[model samples]
Target chain A: MIKHKALLTLFLSLFAVSGLFAAKPVPPAKKAAPPAPAVITGLTAVDMPYDAGNAAILKWAVNPADAADTFYVVYVSSLEAGGWLEADRFVSSAKTGKDVELPFWAWDGSSLEHAVKVELNNTYGDTLPGSVFQFKVAAEKNKQVIAESMPVSVTPVGNWFRLDRMNNLVLLITIIVIFFWAVSHAKRKGLFIRRIAGLDAIDEAIGRATEMGKPIFYVPGIGSMSSISTIASAFILGEVSKKVAQYDSQIKVPHYDPVVMTVCKEVVKQSYMEAGRPDSYREDINQFVSADQFSYAASVDGMISREKPAACFYMGYFMAESLLLAEVGATSGAIQIAGTDVEHQLPFFFTACDYTLIGEELYAAGAYLSREPMLVSALKVQDFGKLFVMISVFFGMICVVLGAKFGWSAFVSSVLNLFQNF
Target chain B: MKLIKKQIPLAIVFITGVLTLISYYVPHKVSVDYIETMNKWENIVVAFAFLLGLISLFFSHYHKITRKADGWGYSIFVFIGFLAMVVPSYTSHGKQMVDGMLTPLGWSYKYIYTALSGTMFAVLAFYIVSTAYRSFRIKSAQAFVLFVAAFILILGKVPLGQIIWDYALGWTGQGVSAVIEWIMQVPAVAGKRGIMIGISIGAIVTSLKIIFGIEKQYMGKD
Candidate 1:
């Protein structure tokens, strides 16, 4: 009886411990399938012009909290039969945030650049069709999406106009206006401009050569005659040739362009005929040295040295060659009268030559020398325009100063914008 | 009769001017058509005019070469160079021929042209040195001022300037850059503005004369 009781007690204790340890493992509550990513919102499309090779920009809003413990995904499709084929698909961790522009190149071209848009999703589960996107604002604490935002459709419209092109509009208008005004003014009465000092100096220069019995060396610039300024130079050459003919002085016209040489020959011949000294004109009056800038300079320099001309006229467009020619003329003790619109070379000519016509003065030389009334009137109108500009500038400056002191920033800014547009 | 000759060209000028002005304001289909026509005609005229210069170039040089004038060899070289550039150009349409032909020829031109031209100019440096040694001999206050200005300008532009005046050339906050900017802005701008104002006034007076038919130089004769 004692042995049986001991065995029974041990069995009971073992059963009690087993029962205490055998509590069942708790099963997880069945999870509901994640809803599709709260429909995407804030879709935008813009056309980019610079890189038309093949591309566009797309952007959308994302929110992650709405679809329980879900990630966000994006999808895109064409408007054509290929309904929403994934152009580019990507997954996102957040459901409510800004995303960079994604590209969609399905129908991109010069015409169809801004025609694509995108859709977004928050569902981590399998996707279904015929579903509209509704974006939800994410809830705090658990970062759960609370309510969906109105879905935005992506519209592919590339940037409508270029920013750089807008900047050029005013400049283009100004150039056109200036050009037309001058041309019209010239047509009305013909241009009669004042006598440029350099042109005036030309007569004196050639006369001095006649008196001195020294040759007159004329360098008709180192550029082609087709250049407008060079044509202007050639016109001046006609006047110079007439004077040379009348004065019975020898003229040496060295050139760089073969075309310019022919034009120069014609101009000189015509001027001699007009001056009633056609018999005095010679082929040597117009000669081509070289098309090379420095070579021409060197050759001219040699001529200046050997011929020892009494008067040297450096007229036309010059570069570094200006200084070289000026220095040689200086060495040869020639009375140099230089006319050029090359602004950079002006200072060198100012330093070395007896007279130097500044930029634009060369263009004025024909009008001034010939007293072309049309040229003069165009210049007057240009002056009026300049006066208008100055008045506007002065008034604008005053307004700016007053505005700054009185704290009228908005008014000043608007005025500035207007001026900028003007 | 006088007005007919003078006024018509003026009328043409004014009409063209007004048309261009109207063009800027109007964005209508007619305006667009006019602009396109103008651009097309301009391009066509420019294309035709370009031939004048080219023909003149060939004729003038060919005459020189045929007559065996001074520098006839240079004329031949120029003709050959012109043909070399032109022949290959008319042969091809795009970058392919340019890559195969123009590039090589351009390279050769650069070598021959640059070297010959550069050597001719490099001789000037010696001439300048000698000229300076003689011409720059101190003569007057004006001459002295000129000399000093030239010296400063030339030295300031060169690499050795900073070497001589370390503090002057140093990239520190207070240095030559600040001074240079000040010089460019203050005196340079002032001088440029003054010159511009004078030029404007002169131009205005000239234009007035031109419009009144008081100036006749561009008309070929009195």
Candidate 2:
């Protein structure tokens, strides 16, 4: 009986061990090999248009099955055989061809493909014209590269014309033709320009300074020689200084830029010579105050307060310091004239200044003050340009409205594209 | 001498101006290189001009001090301030900070220069208030319009303004902020765009005048 019981226990123990072995979980069938991530297709490399042969645009069609996290790594090489260096990496959905900035006339951008502008100069220091470059793109998922595109090559060459800016070129040419026509016409028949009160008040301001026996202060507001407003101010200063010289009145020109100061000195000297009072032209008329904006304003303000100049002229580019200088001049009982192209600061000038040149008036001041045939013709050309723009805007509005109402998308887009800068 | 001073500069201006205009249309490598080189040259020229400016500043103050001009005492402060900053710069080898602590140069910039600049900037607030007072006095039809626009603009920007707007004009089913947006986007933008268009056309004409040598006032010739 004991032997039979022992045999049963041994059989049960063996059965239990077998059951444990049977219940063990199997390895997850090796994840079904992860489905082999889809590869990008139809890769093409072309030299970027409207560029200096230093960039190439790579485009490729992406498979719809690509995961959102799937990344594309762009590799570039001077040699086709090897030495592939990673140029850029981006997620699958990052860049599409539609995101390109080129106009429709230059590029046929499609939403179905990826596009990238690879700057060759960034990779190879300098990319000479007609230099061959090879590129490859690898699609990666879960940190593993799934597939690579066939190596595509491009020979970047500089283009002669930027087709993208064709509209701008056309407009520029039109303006130039108008300018030449206006110049010839002006010489034959003088152009008519409306009175600018600010420019008209120049003689008044200068005469007041002469009457008071106080110096005239000209603050060429904190702009470099390159600024158009500063150039205008220099011209006005020439005319004013000539008048000052004739009247034997003192004038002080506080400069913010050294180059402008240098230029203004020549202008004042010439004006004095023109007025036949060269002996009275002082070298200290033009002085460099400070390069720092507020410091210059403070120094000018202090001078205006102390010297009690009869008239003050603030012209050129001014920031917040506009009010600081203008208010001080106003408080000093000086007749102040201010002009700037900065639209936001116009209100401050209008409030504080006795005469304020708004927008184009500032540019027109030089021409108006000089009344030269050639200079006045430029103003007429500008007016013609304005008329052209007004007509274009009016016609553009009509066309856009008609196109939208009639479902003429192509016409609307063309009109809109003509107005677009790029 | 005429060739050197007048004709050469005019020729240079004509050549460079035309080339710059052409470069705007052309994307060729040579054109790009020319623009880059020209910009670098401009920076170098500006640096030398800065040196010239420093010399002029020194001479102007020096003359004032020597002559015992009206503000001779103030002129002495200019030299003192210039040396105070420049001496520390040379001694510290142009390092503003050393081991995360301010050097003498840095201290001067922070404690003295920036503080003075900030004080000057702070004074602008009072100036703005005075300007606004004079501007919003309802002197004419234009002034009335400006007053109304400015009042709306200022009122829509603050929390208290929004609360007052909600209580007063909320019945219109649009917020005061919406009115402000319309004023800014429609009327203000229209006026601004008009001015901008005129300015742009003027600028272009001026550029052409310079390029063609029609306007030589900058050359001080008439």
Best-performing candidate as measured by lDDT: 2
Writing each residue's lDDT as its tens digit, candidate 1 over B1-222 gives 657755675665456646755555444436656888977876666455446545655676788688987666766876776666556445543233363555544554566667768987887676566556554666778668657655555656766774654556465554444555666687767767656654544444443333444443333343
State how far residue A202 of model 1 sits from its true place (Å): 2.1
For model 2, residues A144-207, the per-residue Cα lDDT tens digits are 9988999999988889999999989889999998889999999999999888888889899889
Question: Candidate 2, which segments miss by more than 4 Å at Cα?
Answer: A1-39, A62-73, A78-97, A111-113, A121-131, A140-146
Model 2 alpha-carbon miss at residue A300, Å: 0.6
Q: Count the backbone clashes (under 3 Å) in each candidate.
A: 62, 0
- What C-alpha lDDT, on a 0 to 100 scale, does residue A157 get in candidate 1? 28
Per-prediction TM-score: 0.57, 0.89
lDDT values of the candidates? 0.61, 0.89
